[model samples]
Target: MRYMAAIVLAAALLSGCQGADKAGVNGSSPSSQPEVSPTAMSATPSAPASSSMEEPLLYIEQLRIIGGGQLVQVKSNIDIDQKSLEQALKNSLQTSDPETEFRYTLEWESPRFVQIRLHLDENSVWSGTFNLDEAVTVDGRKYASTEQPYRNTVVIRAGDGEGSLLFQGVTSGTRRVVPAWNTGWIKPVQTRESVAPSYLFYGQEKHHLVHALTGEALEIPVFAQEKDAYGNDYGYHEMYSDRFYEDFTYMISGNKTLYRVDLKGFTSKKLHVFNKPVYGMSSSPDSKRIAVLTAHDEFIGPGADLTVLDQQGKILHSRENAAFISHSDGFLFVYSLAWEDDSHLILPADRDEHNPLGQIRYNTGNGASSVMQDERITDPLKQDLKEHERQPHNDLLLSGLKWSPDNRFAAFKSGTGAIQVYDTQERTFTFVSAGTLLGWMPDGTLAWADIKDLVYTF
Candidate 1:
């Protein structure tokens, strides 16, 4: 229930960090966040670093937040003793400890490169360059580019000792994201042949080898890969059809589910096979249950059958052909799970023959179904969405939804790029335009990604 509230705090707490130049939010918590104008923010710098004396906390580690083509800002320890590292961050994050003179190392990720940051204390702004040595070797060559000089000059402010490392890049920039700890982050994609879309990163949190792109399916860490309650490996452990692509188009049921996987060393038992072909599906938030749509059929339109199951693959309940016999709104059937709630499922219905408009929603735990939005308006936004790209969501797929860890919110963008919150609980709308953005901050404030020049929109 407090899912939305948590993000609000995160956004506000970090808004004063370097990249939040357009934000004017300031508050200790979300409920009291105050609004500031663009003009007001332009007049000041991020809040001067704080001076807490306790051991610095790490807010971000491992993963870097990539936006457009560059790293925005590293989110790290939001609360830190600002006085500890004043001189060490002059060049990089690694520095000799002021008191013990011991080694301190840190790493960073970007859209195009990987870097290491070293700091000795909390206060020092970066020195003129990235390192003290005159030159560094690359590929056994003492290469130096005058145009792209090595910059060790790093800066830090209050509570940023544990910040997430951010890098510089543009969305279309030619630079590529290189991996640092080869074993920790990236791994050889098991597909054998790599081209066009080549490479896989161990999604530590999701427990899969997720493709960086929007469309491909990543391998789920199952059985044999499960090393422990924690420390599991995510790689090709068993024999799965290399020729088949996981086009998981439906969210019928389960916290997480796959019809089948072949893991090695670890044994598994088959619970239930589909009575028919599997189609769309959704799973509960707890990951204990599952719901799936049956195989596709070419009627006047596409129709589906719904199936429910448990983690052990045991059939709980089955519903066949539960969807309408229309495909005009093909996008509505994009997924069967609500974004916000794991306890619900979305079923698509034809708005009309052309499939331009469709109805979609989920069956909540209350034994009641909720319509995402009535079929009273047009789908409005349209573009060439490749089968894999899912963001810049369609309203039908997101409306009347719920979140598990409260990671995402149900918001809508109109033709003009204005986004409004469709609060599922209040059933009311709060609009944010180019003028204002309302998202959750680490400290529970209304935070948002403020865009300047509109080079692209989806």
Candidate 2:
């Protein structure tokens, strides 16, 4: 019932973190954390070089934050009372006490990176930089180690007049994203065997993939366009079989029927005949599993179902009303359900009294479903919304949720006309232009197409 409120809170919180240019380091206790912007980092000057008799209430170990291709700040969270860290202007490195231990955490400030570390001794904290030297300084405190460098840098260019550009590589660390060639309005593609690859675009009648260099039009007749109420034609979803591309599959949800078609054999199967339209679909990486979702439009609060099938077209599992919520709009947003792997499928679940905007990860092999919670959005906001209108409002904007071929990133189109990419490994997010994410290319670069069928890679 509070799904909408949870989403509103999530958006505001995510935005706040994005706009802030600093990393925050504070005591383990919430009350001890400072409200200072994490970005204000500088080298601290050396202090008097003698240990003071004053006892430290806290023992801070270390803290660091990096952003925009450079280390933004580094502070050794060590109190000056116990040990006189002042060894100014000289860059001498000495190992600290072998028994000393610290805690570390890496946070991606959306488009940037931030890492914070702190040393703690039981309940006490030694907060601030230690061992002043010449290499770097934080808040005027000198340190022996140099700041960490940026991990990556990327550049995106809108295509020339023809709406096309080449895909060379992405700018990261020392490497840069450069184009290899140019062409007319088209969608460039990265294939299994090639990097300087071809283009896939919608022609006057159908879709085609043309070789960028040779100008050869590779015919792909499987993509058929269907017209909507306004007479605008649009193509449906199609994906190739994993691994060798030996087969491909697609879906066509008609008025009362859902068609699962195998492009390799040019065969169509009526997977389901439902009174309500089929709303969502996704396939597993191994091409052996498929999950389909459907919902009803009615006076009932809101409800949806999920059905999984195997390679032999047999129903493996089905859950009715797995997602149910109450809102004035009575909207049940089955945004997207995806297979994390052959055995795991992740779906959005309604936020209840216990779980915040939570997601359900179902293990097909074990029939176990667990919730993967994100604290950023789950935490309640200061403002409250009317209970009846609390249905998830942003679900439609994120209906196109998809995972990259490599499973390292989950790419979804944000309402802001950009793609929000979630790095599974780093547990961080980055933004890209609004394009149809074609998954990872042969060379490990991300590829997508804009409204005009212009392909870009990063």
Candidate 3:
């Protein structure tokens, strides 16, 4: 059971010096300030000062800025050797606009890990943690140190902010070099209501009809009373097979019984029932037919049967072991079992040597199955793999491919934990915040949920 509530949009503003001491800035000045070195800072952690020196040098490890339609990872090395750490940071970090200034707060989690909250303004703030012990590389340039005596490497985690920052780094045999900002990476767009759409979602208490454009949600009492094998009112539960039939009507399954519900009047009628448990359901584009995927037995294991039914609950076609069930993280569910048209259904087939996980196009008219050859589905998967290879870490495989209602956009989880949306029309990709890709709204806006908030985006 998934628990969710209304979205909470809060701007986190961290203030004051809470963990600045952990950064090795103890307000006590060095016995003697060494002459500023003209040599470029080394990418590795600075060597520890000798017993004659009073303080160790500080270095900027990793700095990332997310805003202004761009995600920037600064590929430069900065060394600070001033008497005051506060004055050194203030002089080093600056925004694009000279008129606007910024403030920051640091909270030390461990000796080397510190959480930084940078506030550019009341509306724009970013908070992320930096681990000084790890080394991260963007493109070909690297920042921070691999191990201790702990270099002053600052890696800012992704946070909510708007605007850009400009900072200079040191290069060998030079006075000071301001490296060019790498803007080649994908930019994260702001969440806007203009591109959002209306949709329905199952909440912790009941069903919610959400209007994304206006940010309004209406509660709809539609949860069926679930019962155990002994026939007691176990609790209220929403099944995975529950889906919308057009905009106002919904088809949901409880136990082995199916119900057709009208949202406007809150009325429900019996549709159909299967001998076993219902695994998944999808309504046709025309809403004239429904395709249901059911488990073969109560155990609900690997294989499932497919049943196509008309709006009148009459079975148009039925096949045993027509769809294959895949398990992930201990959850048993069928893959995409959607209707390509009123007469054809696209469903997963059993695994084979040639096609380990494949799908087939099942024709309801002739009861024939054929290999699915739609490039609209296959091309984006190939693109995800290609995109994954370009990432710094390629071990994280892409999963959870979800297409929009109009089939204009496809979304999936990328290797970096961010949700990457592929625009099939433009043949481009955009990165969004990390979350689970919920179903798309009627107007094609994508909905997703992180641990705390439910975000709607396009």
Candidate 4:
């Protein structure tokens, strides 16, 4: 699943574009352009002339921000006199030099408001935010324009000492805003582990961990045993729980053992190991219990086993399944299991006439199990699982299902590409949007990547 996510992320970054168009990084002239969203356009579709016109007149009207703070769309009044508005625009428009100019293109045709695209290009085009609301009269108001140079050198350091970094280009203005770790990064608590390094297939390099936000290097303690089977040193691949940086458990697969380590005391405890090679694991919310799903070929066996163990390596529960044992099959069967709470594990069970993907709620408190169904069956709409939803790959989609930190809501991508949030209390499935699941914000807000792969928060 991690590898799959890496591939998707790579493709998204390569194709990510700003605003409505995948225009060139340096702003292009507004002659021929792609159509913008209706919300971003004015009522008229024909673009006003840019070359011969003395001034580009734009009627100001209702203005609203969209795409977080990245877009501003406005409706221009259609009844205004074109010549008078053009003259007013001429007075307001200014350029620094021949290489830089303010360009405009008209968009949309509707009963009310005309849409326009405005760009200011120096080396790159910039869009600005405006709060103008009043109708234009001849007394022109002077607005100050600032030009910022693109700086090639921008250094960012970890302030809280840990987090993830997203590289971004300047969206607006000349201020060459290179994304830095100091802003828009999530800082987790620092650990003894050095940030993991990017790996190359055939090399003997010392790997380091990078902060999730700051991109700073971090070094994690992988117990006293740090070398692999061939006595080669390698970095660890960690699996963190929902608690994330605040409090969680992590396990390193190298050295054929699982060791639980703390960032504060640097204490190490060996959890478990299959006599043969083991592949993947998932930790419970409280970090007291861990489910280790082993590889199928690790031993000559007809069925694979899912082993639940305490932090001290005490076996609590184990079950057999023909499907659970193999990672080579491209799916982790254990992904179907979601922790309903610290004391309850929700595992998929057999479906019946009423419940489609039946669930078995296993009580970790007493090693008991019970059947659980989607309470929505009582609704008058009465929806059942569709054919495509029952596919084996659909179980993998469950891996995207993220319950809110408080367990109030569960967000997952439906087979149809729409993200749905299941309200545990209300017993209802509400359509959030058509997007890929990212994760929930610390404040419990849901975030996702839309059809275009742009991240959005709700």
Summing lDDT over every window of 10 consecutive residues in candidate 2, give the lowest-scoring window. 148-157
lDDT of 3 by residue, 45-148 (tens): 33343332223323332222233111111111233222233343444342222334434554342332333334434333222222222232222222332232
Candidate 2 local lDDT, 1-458, one digit each (tens): 00011112223222333443433333231222222322222333233343433211111112221211112222233332112222321122211122334342233232212323333342221111122233222223323222211101111112232333222122231211223223222443433444445655644444456554455555555434333311211223332221122344535333234455553555666565544545456677666676766664543235667777775556888887665445444332224466777788877666654544446888877778887654323112101111111223444423334545455555665432344566555655554443445444444455544333233221
Candidate with top lDDT is 3
Point out the worst 10-residue segment of candidate 1 by lDDT: 36-45
Candidate 1, residues 242-291, lDDT tens digits: the string is 12123221121122234443333223444444433333444554456666
Ranking by lDDT: 3, 2, 4, 1
| Candidate 3 pairs with clashing backbones | 40-171, 61-153, 61-154
Model 4 C-alpha lDDT per residue in residues 252-321, reported as the tens digit of each score = 4452466675645656666776553333355675567776545445443323445678878788887555
Q: Cα deviation of 121 in candidate 2 (Å)? A: 61
Task: Return the TM-score for candidate 3, rounded to 2 decimals.
Answer: 0.53
Give, for candidate 4, the lowest lDDT window spanning 10 residues: 149-158
| CA lDDT scores, all candidates in order | 0.31, 0.39, 0.44, 0.38
Top TM-score: which candidate number?
Answer: 3
Please list the residue runs of candidate 3 whose C-alpha ends up more than 4 Å from where it truly belongs after superposition.
Answer: 1-20, 24-197, 212-218, 229-236, 240-248, 328-335, 349-358, 374-411, 421-430, 438-458
